[model samples]
Target: MTSEVRAAVFRPDDERIADAVDLLESLGATPVPDPMLAVEPTGATPAPADWTVLTSKTGVELAAEAGWTPTDTRLACIGPATADAARAEGWAVDVVPEEYSSAGLVDALTAAVATDESVGVARSDHGSAVLLDGLREAGIETTETVLYRLVRPVDAGESTARAAAGELEAALFTSSLTVEHFLDAAAERGVRAAAVEGLADAVVGCIGEPTAATARDHGITVDVVPDEATFEALATAVVERAAPSHHGE
Candidate 1:
């Protein structure tokens, strides 16, 4: 007989949140769906290049919606999820690094791409400089096109409040931005210290090493960083760790 586990998820206010809620519930955790990130499309597509790199599923979907195509250019994705999104849109993914991070993209492209070839990186406005810098250092020409902007939703403080009140058993951070946005919300609510202190006792899960690093930088102890950098992995690991008695599901 396991007690209810109150877990917080900070995805966008879109199908992402719905899917995250479903996953948490299936794992027997009461999900606190606080949308921390909202996507605003830039209405600009990636420029034509020898190789085009996409870093997120949302970017892939947005590009598809804009009737964008590879047009003889090779497609590269930062992770399996982004690759899957592109594949679903009938785009052939040429490269997906085994590491699944900016550094990973840099290594993969550096090894495969020629210095003469140009790469276009399409992602959110908050995209990391690691990828672009890595490519540039390798002498490969790379350009970035902001596909969208990720903004903190106004109603994103519920999870921070829950954490401050010690009502949350776990928190799943999907990205570094989510961690920053969560802290921002906490600060805005005047409960940043309390929330960080409360989270010290609860399970904090980050989707990847970068997200975990961000959580730790904010004085939040991270307990889990799943091998796969995906929302499902992060949520499932957090729920299982927070409620060990209910693992069979």
Candidate 2:
């Protein structure tokens, strides 16, 4: 049997979905695109700050949408891809920690900032508060701005849900919102049980511990979690899991 990967990409952009698809193909697995959420910028005004932290590429896109410029402030990114996105927007990246997480960014910022430097965080409305809390505890002035919001897709086709049920051998979740959106889409298609159980059997992969925890909360066991929470790392984990020895050759 050909190794087929059922991927649940919550990213709204086709390019993002294509990245997942390419990963699956490279592993000799057929990819099935089943996006569960759509990302939209909140149109919030950017305030002046000494430093700006970007947690996601979507957040970077939102900052661009709001006409924010890096020339006016320092930029810190949670991961290299986010940093690259910021750089693409002509922003200078001041810091990108070795570990790719908001907490990691906070730790890096804590070490770099003076006692009086005010930092602004651009992130989703719903996300972990670990970064904000850590920054505040470290005496760094932190202001969180909601940049983008994830909305569950209203038009999930039944065929996609059925694919999630019967054909997808593995599902990759990148965030908590992806998990929630997958559950919501599955429930809407009346395949909640199938979706959950199928994911449990399949090689469910997560980008980080937080996303893995979210999968666990939904009774979906994460079979693979990469060391770094980057797209490249996540793709590597998926490929490794699908390898013959890893899957019991």
Candidate 3:
């Protein structure tokens, strides 16, 4: 296809960026690495607990850097990607929910650990409270340790210009913060309305439903969302929705 899809990956630089870029290229799309979020270590660590829960790969990286590793405690992750990130550090993951969301993680934990067990939820500053509330409702004690903070990017001027001129074909958001910050950036660039209209012309894909919800709330319609909340899955969703000729038609 002569019309190459260009999708903005609005996430911080990490080990996953390379993989996402490679996937987009393989699908005949240009992977725009205009990260809309910045990663900052929170100086917090996930100490050993009865059940250690990891919410994102960033958290796992920070916790490992802090000299924390999996002990006899069971490891529960919010998604398969997070689980893989944990296992990369030699931690045995005991739970990876099929749903791949905060609510799904709670169900996995409720089934894997007894109500009397303590759960240590490790994540960044943008971590959700759904799991904490869900665990509490399940009669499980939970402790949260912030491992990093995602700095929102409020200047998508370059991306907005490219989009407004029709040089962009798609955009991908991995988190709600990404959606929020991208719009904030667009407004700062004085192209919020144009960006919204441009995104309508391009394929807008999100990593999951929550991010998609945020995008819609901000008046940006989403075209694709993967069944699984992983970078690879998101890329696949974008490619499939874009219908690149190289994707076996």
Q: What is the C-alpha local distance difference test score of each model?
A: 0.91, 0.76, 0.81
Which candidate has the top score in TM-score? 1
RMSD of 2: 2.1
Task: Give the higher-lDDT candidate: 2 or 3.
Answer: 3
The C-alpha TM-scores of every prediction are 0.95, 0.91, 0.91
lDDT of 1: 0.91
Enumerate clash totals for all models, in the order shown.
0, 0, 0
Best by lDDT: 1
**TM-score of model number 1:** 0.95
TM-score, model 2 to reference:
0.91
Instruction: Give the residue spans of candidate 3 off by over 4 A.
Output: 153-157, 244-249
Which pairs in model 1 have colliding backbones? none
Compared with the true structure, what per-residue lDDT tens digits does model 3 show for residues 92-149? 9888888889999888888888856788888888877788899889988888888888
lDDT of candidate 1 over 1-249, digit per residue (tens): 237789989889989999999999998899999999999999999999999999999999999999899987999999998999999999999999999899999999998898689999999999988889999989999899999999998878998989998898899998899999999999999999999998987889999887888889889999999987778888888888989564454
TM-score: which is higher, 1 or 2?
Answer: 1
Which pairs of residues have clashing backbones in candidate 2?
none
Off by over 4 Å in 1: 244-249
